[model samples]
Target: MDTILYPLEWFVAFVMVGFHKIFSTIGLNAESGWTWALSIVGLVVVLRILLIPLFVKQIKSSRRLQLIQPEMQKIQAKYKGKKILSPARSRPRK
Candidate 1:
């Protein structure tokens, strides 16, 4: 949890700073609701850009899984097992 604080702060600060700069350039106050709205848009665009590669990788992964679907189904059909048994362990009473 502690490790996540820096990234969270960085993202928030990034959006705020971006908003401030844009607002300053456009002669709008940083505290305006419109400024905040555009800042959120800026954040969304930045995040989308950053995640593009990950999204592409995920798409590729899904395609690979799709390709394997037939084989997986065949394996499941072969297994068509009723139930799986596992060794049970006793828990101590409090």
Candidate 2:
């Protein structure tokens, strides 16, 4: 995962540098390192905002699965030692 992420990190750094250069050209106080820092922070803020909905959906789905876990376990126990498609046989059919 680190191998896959390294390039992505580099790409983000490159974009931030490019953005800093553009801001400098526009005379937006980009001469200071703070401009690059703020750009990266802004990017993080935007990404977090975008992921909020996805995070909420994941939490809801996880809660629903938790609610169904007991019923799923009961089902497993009820079918224990029984052939799923052959109720009259003890061994599984070939």
Candidate 3:
């Protein structure tokens, strides 16, 4: 588990460190706890911006699927009384 999480941990730490550097360079109190907190908040905002497009596409796809679901149900209802034969049923016993 540690091995699997190592890369993920490193990635999160790297993002935090990068943000810390940005704050330090801009004359912020980088050594203060609030600076670290702001770095984390910044990461969240960046991630949300990146994911907004994906979230919108997922919502649109869901609506399209919903529109087709009734048609699919109608097709299923059309065939509700039909019977299907299996190979075992078509074979004779010894």
Quote each prediction's TM-score.
0.72, 0.56, 0.68
Candidate 2 lDDT by residue in tens digits, 1-94 = 9998999788677767777777778787966877888777766876688889999999999999999999999999998998665565857768
**Candidate 1, 29: how far from true, in Å?**
3.6
The parts of candidate 3 lying over 4 Å away from their true place are 76-94
* lDDT tens digits by residue: candidate 1, 1-94: 8687989888778776877688768987766788777877888888899999999999999999999999999989987975655455344447
Relative to the true structure, how large is the alpha-carbon lDDT of every model? 0.82, 0.82, 0.90
- Residue 32: error of model 3 in Å? 0.8
- What's the distance in Å from true for residue 90, model 1? 20
User: What TM-score does candidate 3 get on C-alpha atoms?
Assistant: 0.68
* Model 2 lDDT, full chain set: 0.82
lDDT of 3 by residue, 1-91 (tens): 9999999789778888899899988888977998899899988887788889999999999999999999999999998988967999978
Query: Number of clashing pairs, model 3?
Result: 0
Q: List candidate 1 stretches off by more than 4 Å.
A: 82-94
Name the best candidate (by TM-score).
Answer: 1
- Which pairs of residues collide in candidate 2? none
